[model samples]
Target: MARQNTVHAAAAVLVVVPTYNERENLATLAPRILAQGEQFHLLVVDDDSPDGTGPLADELAAADPRVRVLHRASKGGLGPAYIAGLTTGMKRGFDYLVTMDADHSHDPADLPRLLAATHDARADVALGSRWTAGGSTRGWPLRRRVLSRGGSAYVRLVLGVDLRDATAGFKCIRASALAALEIDTIGSSGYAFNIELNYRATLRGFRIVEVPIVFTERITGASKMSGRIVAEALLRVPALRTTSLRPLADVRPLADARPT
Candidate 1:
């Protein structure tokens, strides 16, 4: 699964995928992500999976220059893992930073379209939307479909994020937008992180576009969705609406964001 060339130091794009005990998925996922294009580099931020996902990712990184691994001490929540990943991308001066799931629910093939959507629309964030026209899900249970739809709808209504799939995990974010939003300051530590990211970006008037993508249920391993995660998102959405999110700058013009 090794590619001939290493990721260039000045490569413009980086995809940060967070993993926890996703060894089965990682072995199959890394090569596909790398195959997307030569311009893309991948960073696997593993939460020190006791399942040995960390070592597996390290082996992949060793074989391929485009692949890199970030080993965290424990299974921190999705937000912290992503925060660390995005922060690393920005520090390395990448122009684009993308986030994805290691579960293969998010298609690696859709990666380019996300980046392209951001570029074509001059948007700061591109969401891989399952509710948008042309988007679909394969093998997803009806309950999950309902939960995702209802939750995102709630997020949209309460937080004013103007996207059909505001809670989507797959996304491509422009580095400039990351710095502008000050993503590090976001406080949510659970799955609500997706909504929080979009909400903050919208508040800052950053352009967010949706590209229809097919989300598939994993064929291997256990799903991470849990009661606590759902509750966290449910509790966090209203707080985001009521709480005041300070901007990176004291005086910045708020753009009136509308659905696209």
Candidate 2:
């Protein structure tokens, strides 16, 4: 753990937030994340949010050098947006990269704890887990809670990964670990992407740690969850379990990208 601390003491961190019609949330979340400290940078990847979220992101980036935005042509999916952002972060030489919900569901205040876990545990990835000890959720309906918990359990059983919250979205990953994944080839584009990435990291022998956090349901915008997204996840879990890890050299180089 001490080794990690020393290695990343002055490391640059990029928090990649994928957004879709989250203008209201970003109005507040962006400032809060920037306030975390100078060591962290914020990247908002907007999937052509029709609600003018992409323009808002540009305004934020223009106002602060620490903030940047990535504009996509259409609403592809969460996984691809993150892959694009992570690839951008890696190419730009960031030492650590994080992914979290753009909505207020993920508290910006808890980011420090996740970063601390990354250093303290010497972990290649730190998951903000609601299922781990000291973790909890707020404002979620009973049915949603049940589904999330059940989903994690099923993923663990199917993937044989020991993680408590395989579907957790808030996480910090060492750039080295991310680069090792050959992220461009990742197939899952829904919630299952979280499980697939975690499982892949485990197979690559990287240390993964969980940090407890309270996940609150978003108060604004609409939830992206849908029947099709859930079904895609269920179908992808078995495919991930059977796929072999790709070699680093085989990973296609991602083009350099910037805020649009």
Candidate 3:
């Protein structure tokens, strides 16, 4: 059995926020993320936001030891930003790494539920789902809802993933699951990245679980869900399902053990 302190110390859950020009949202969202008690670390990966979100992240990090910032030169999409954060988290030896939007679409309060699902429910990857029972969406336009539901259904059929909110950005992923992946091989960006990660995990036999979360439209900042992102996801879903290459490692069984 793993030592209690090992599990507790390794249990550094950092909320990874990939940002680009999210100045409006960052100001408000950062505080909310920090307010999720002191259990989580907030990692704000700014793609050198011309809107000054990077400096804001620095300012926030300086104020809070639990907060940190990673700066990238240009807007390389959400996938790269997350990869950067994941790499840093792995190097620093954290046990759990979470990815969510800085735009407030993913609530900070839901963080604890996702964490509990991972620790108590024995899930390798706990997803915050809006399509599951007790889950819902608020303040979204009809077109957005239709697009999301249709895209999710299409991916489910094509990729054969059983997840309800496969495209959702809110997730609590164990570092062990991430270490099992050849993340360097993941080539998709934006929405496609989400599907690719989940698909690869399923292929490696990870114990993924969904926790219901109410999805809400961002109260500030312009939405970044572009047509290109959607199109890329639609295309990548089929390609990933056909790949037979095994992952770098298989840690699904570790997810079976209760979090110490």
Best model number under lDDT:
2
Q: For each candidate, what TM-score against the reference?
A: 0.89, 0.90, 0.89
Taking the tens digit of each residue's C-alpha lDDT, what string does model 1 give over 1-260? 12322323234689999999899999999899888778789999999899999999999999988888999999999999999999998998888999999999999888777766665456678888898777889998898899889987898788756677879889998888889777888888888898888888877766677788999999999988889988999998898876565342111111222324
Evaluate candidate 2 by giving its C-alpha RMSD to the native, one decimal. Answer: 7.6
lDDT of 2 by residue, 59-127 (tens): 999999999999999999999999999999999999889999988888887776667656545667788
Off by over 4 Å in 1: 1-11, 243-260
Order the numbered candidates by TM-score, best leading.
Answer: 2, 3, 1
* Worst window of 10 by summed lDDT in candidate 3: 248-257
| Cα lDDT, model 1, residue 195 | 84
Question: Candidate 3, clashing residue pairs?
Answer: none
Candidate 3 wrongly placed segments (more than 4 Å)? 1-10, 245-260
Residue pairs that clash (backbone atoms under 3 angstroms), model 1: none
What is the lDDT, from 0 to 100, of the residue 80 in candidate 3?
82
